[model samples]
Target: MMKKTDGEKNKFSLWLLAWPIFIEQFLQFLLGSVDTLMVSKISDNAVAVVGFSNQLFNALMTLFATVASGAGIVIAQKIGSRKDEEARTVAIIAFKVTTWIGVFLSILLIAIPAPIATMLQMPEELLPLAKIYISIVGGGMILTAMMSVLGTAIRNTGNTKGPMMIAVGMNIVHIILNYCFIFGAFGFPQWGLTGVAISTVTSRLLATVVLFLMFLGTFERKMGMKDFSIFDRKLFKEILTIGWPLGVNSGSWVFSQLAIFSFLAILGSSELAARTYMSTLESFCFLLGFSLALAAQIQIAHLYGAGKIKEAYKAVYRVLAIGLPLVIVNAFILVLFGGNVLSLFTKDQEILTICASLLWMNLLLQPGKMINMALGNSLNAVGDTRYTMIVSLIFMWLIATGCSYLYGVHLGWGIIAIYACMIVDEYIRGVLSFVRWRGRKYLRMKETELERESTKFTESFASPSM
Candidate 1:
């Protein structure tokens, strides 16, 4: 029998992880699109409300997702190093930490909905609906947080199918509930924006339950009460050491986005809704790139942990090589069919015109966006998170937000100019991240960290007090 070459094995691993994740994220991204399409039929104000509510909800969710991000990298490395018990323990810790954070944030959002709505500059007419939507989904964030950690951890172990199944089932439930509640179908009362929120929360809650059962069924791989009973100081510190920076990185992006939304509000809610529709369509392109990037991250993490640093580096380029062109072609098609796509949401000629023009800009934006997505995930997976965070803060805040306000608001260059400024941000960061990848700083750091973890894992098993 012939043995598989290392290259062939790597190819199998990448595809094994990538395709399921792509399908999962596609469905997840579709949730927002479905909400926007259905809400667009209700009223322009309702559409704008959904847009703002989504932004705020996503920002908070990103913050809650930090623990999962850290845990994912650690778990991936542990699995690669063949330390299954340690990986399972880290997964359980991640579940607890994120769930507590989610509960806290839920209460905070429920209590301060008005402040959040005001911060997003939600229109006065839409503010009431926005508050209701945020409160319901925000209050149910514990479910979202748990599901996120479970999905990330399992994917790190090369079980992408578990999360993908959950995402598919949950989205189906959300769509059905949305149809019934949003329009009073099947004797259900019309709930409008509030209905969307309820559907989102309820569906996510179901995902959490399904994920828990799925995670538990792997008897040899399962984590138990004992794993949660004893506190591991090093584990907690590792989680925090990696998690806090990710939280800050995600927070900076969300805040800068809110600032951009505030700037867009000046152009009127119609334009805000237009931007929302355009962004939803653009997410389709990104879903392809982002999923491939994640596949690269998972493979790279394992290779780095197994001390195959050179192979890890090569894996990154291979994924980017495929992902970049795919996204470019996808963006081109989106530009070609821009008007027809926009018409799916609303018949507003002005919004459609503006969205079509933005699709042209997407031609320039998607390449740079793909670069950033690929390298940024690679950097984070190898534990060079702080560098990416610094880069992101600088470009997203100092460059993207500054240019957005100056061109879009002060100069009155409108949405196109703001998008142009954003492109500049994307290219700048993309080039910088590419350069960082070339330098091997993260590679060296990962080598040291993996060695230390190997020692720690061995000691923990031998002495139980190490």
Candidate 2:
């Protein structure tokens, strides 16, 4: 095999790695859209019930996501070091962590789904629908959690395509099942909210099985308690050293968003509907940037792990350069075409208009958002997650969350005003990230040197430019 050179980015190869992620994310992105549509067909109240209740899942996932999300950096490093066994071990630990977390979440949510509904002050008209949606979705949280960790491991190992294909298949199955079960098509029972839940759980179960079977039958990899016991004390320190900062960074940012969501819940049911639809649209709109960000991380983590700091530096910007333009273009698509897109989610003219207005707001915010995503992911990939955590805390908590609270709740300026605060927050973080990159604060000497030496050869390769 030919040697790989430092700082060399095969745009094609990077995209090849990224396309599967893009497709995976695309299908995953459609999840909310599909669920929203399926339940909306049952009733507008069902839509709110389903939408509001999803926060519980998000809140639960937040606690355990680091187990999975932190695995990618470690896996990428192992691959760069050519230590597939270690990568496999990390994957096993991650699986165990999330599996238990999922099981607990399933029990907790199922036990108290009703109380959660009441706590959210969920629209009374939609409480029953909410209960059923929460019961089914929360009951099956284990399956979804399995899907998340394993999928992240799969993607991290440079085998994204298989999972993407499985995601597409499962998505199609879910949509079809939803149609049949929700409306009683094809002689299926017309179960409405319960039907949608059944379809979702069943599809997620299939996705988990397919992913596991792929490892067993195709990849021939098995993870268990034995594998988890092969602990890497050093790597554990490394993982947490880098991963915990990232966890804090990501948590701060996400919590801020959740806080804003909570604020909107108070505005009224219609506001909640508008926020949900806008959020769904934003999910799709943001996919391009996220996929590209994943590509950047994979590229940066591998190249940097292989002691190619110079190339890693160039790679981050190259990936960002490619993604930044796409973000701008996608925003325009949302601006020009958002009306038609939101219409697919709702028949309510007023709700449709609210979503459209929100889409335009998103378009204006995309450039800033793109900068933040590109820089943040790239920075974290290099294990400089402390910066991410600190900056995110400073900005998200004090600036973003505070601005959102004062305007949205205190001033009673409503959802649009709330978003205006968010736009400011996005740009502020975006600019700060850009500035951090220029100052090299995101890539300090200690982490870079440690990473470089980890894979650096005492003896050089024959071809420096391989």
Candidate 3:
């Protein structure tokens, strides 16, 4: 068992946990942005292909996120309740489950990259590059899965710094490798998109290895082969119960985004490239809220596990209070300066004009997204995932996808109108999530369960020892 101390407790505070996650997330965004930036040098078509392929990759990652999210919440709660053994068991199960899923996904993507790319309505000219990038990176899903599970396990233990350090190292390696392969530096052939994909996979492989070693050192008991062999049905059920909704929720967002991407593909390469560039810049604004929401999720899970229901409830509000303003400020900065940032990638006036309009729309979009993330994550932490999942499924498809088709495609309102649809979706879902949290239903349910458990304990003690 890792020794608990004042320092350890202090590390669980929102700010301490969030800052490292924020940096880690920033580096992650940088990793993708760098890929897009470097590849944009090849051509805007290359950037479009890269962005399209990544959206598919992200959709597949929801499978891994299912396991990671489930396991992370369970581990945090178990640790909060001081059930270290259970927490460790959950971690092992998560690793085992994610490995199988990752392998299957890797094979699927690698074997059928062409078909998948075609189904996503990838442009004919882009198919060859898309296939290569997808196969190379997609073949490495196992490494990505391992990294996701390992990072989630480590962070939920309130040791966000370890993952942050790993990300910093991985990103450094990634940039160097990207330069060598993409630009034909260090005597390497200029592989272009293929080189970027290879660099991504290689960097992930290194980070996964380092993360596994760090995972071994973090826990009290050493993990052996037998640990992997062991299966706990109840714990597995708990993980799936919490994880599937999260997976579906994430799936809803990614799939809807993919649908929207296909719509942009119809709009032409200029619109697609513009959307790609804005996504990179807009990530900076939203990641602030995402990092804070993730930290609050961890903290809230711990509090809920320890039966501190009120504290858990208040923690969500605290995160909202802190996160919303920062996200708003960040969005404003992006709106003001996003064009300069876009200029770093492209000089095309049409793309720049499209991206500028999107940034203004993003200012309206981001605050709602921030609110949704803060509240939705809190609900997930307490195992109240179904509501958020349902809300996401309904609104994301209806408002996000349906309206994009209606306003952007069918009515030919264009990309700006598509963004307006998205903004409406975010606020509607955010408001529903807020109402769900405010109702205190999850807290009441948890309290009832605790009382029942208390009754059982009393009954056991009152009876003769058997």
Candidate 4:
């Protein structure tokens, strides 16, 4: 019953969505990378502090991602099903839930950053800088949470360009603020790491406000207070049902990376700095694939919702075919030019040397990761979240975390060994995820659920009123 233009608008095309998302994510990456690059000029220790604090912040952001992911998938499906009113309701709930969660987390982090830092085994010398960064940046997590949910909602509506434009404006503002605050340029006080944190939080606040305004424009009718006041319990449950697994899965990945960072911390500050620098560079490659996978997820969710199972299945392969080669080529380019790129962050021969080795290892690492991302995300699109969640939890903790410790810390094999363990982990998870998608079990399960729901609706109408 949807109009042709409406259907075309909602239809999933990889390039149309992916390009904006890629640019948005890239600028977002640049936001952090700029912080790292600017802070590195101050000292490697400062860079380490920023890296550690961001990891903790990212872990917290995963909690927000839970609601965003759930809301996005549900909204995409509803849009596909022509359930516009329900989709708008889901968006309102997402914004409300993330706001409350964000406020609580922001307060918690602001109140006791030191204890969290201590629990994470933060290096003694780095604690002072870490406390300041965590308190200010972490305290503003509400902005990030709001921004994340807003962006996800906007993107699911296939309006990726809006968020991408916001990111562009945000980065321009962030860079200018960073220069002013970090260096005391233009009469701004030199606040060092605190300045960087302030700049980050301020930019995020502005971005969130703009995104919220854009969100309101997505719906045709005005969304008054009453629309938000109504609580749709069933829809909320559905969001949580799809979202919690994603949260847990992301939490596991973040924790494992944190564990790796912990192990690297034990190796010394040089190792930690190397990890931070390498991560920034590595993101350049993975974000391409990540963007593509995200686009595919949006498309696949639409197809799945419309009961176009064959198209959904084919879509994953198309993404993989495109994503794998692109990622591989990008990874190779990084390997070839990595030393020059890394040199932008640090001049220390030791850190540069460590980064160079990791770049070669990355060539092997990225392809497997691309597979995991494309297929795993495709599976998530179809609501087979539990499978990806369980697999990630098992492998990430056991292989990525455990082996990193066993090889890098306990065995004294060092950071390269830890990187090897990660490579092993990615390929294993990638294989299992591919197997799950190929089996077609999720498609069958979805069909069964749809039939059951249809039957129940029919029975409700057929039976006498109570």
TM-score top scorer? 3
Q: Candidate 4 overall Cα lDDT vs. reference?
A: 0.88
List RMSD in Å for every model shown.
Answer: 4.3, 4.2, 2.1, 2.7
lDDT of 4 by residue, 48-102 (tens): 9888887888888888889988899998888777688888989999999998889
| Number of the candidate with higher lDDT, 3 or 4 | 3
Per-residue lDDT of 287 in model 1: 87
User: Which lDDT tens digits does candidate 2 get at residues 201-242?
Assistant: 999999999997665432226654355556666666666677
- Order of candidates by lDDT, top first? 3, 4, 1, 2
Which is the winner by lDDT between candidate 1 and candidate 3? 3
Relative to the unseen true structure, what is the Cα RMSD of model 4? 2.7
Q: Please, what is the whole-model Cα lDDT of each candidate in the order they appear?
A: 0.82, 0.76, 0.90, 0.88
What is the TM-score (0 to 1) of candidate 1?
A: 0.92
| Residue-wise C-alpha lDDT for candidate 1, range 314-430, written one tens digit per residue | 877987899999989989989888678788889988888888889989999999999988888888877888988899888898778998998899999988888898899999999
Q: Where is model 4 more than 4 Å wrong at Cα?
A: 1-11, 448-466
Please report the candidate that would top lDDT against the real structure.
3
lDDT of 3: 0.90
Q: Which of the two candidates, 2 or 4, achieves a greater TM-score against the reference? A: 4
Ranking by TM-score: 3, 4, 1, 2
TM-score: the better of candidates 1 and 2 = 1
How many clashes show up in model 4? 0
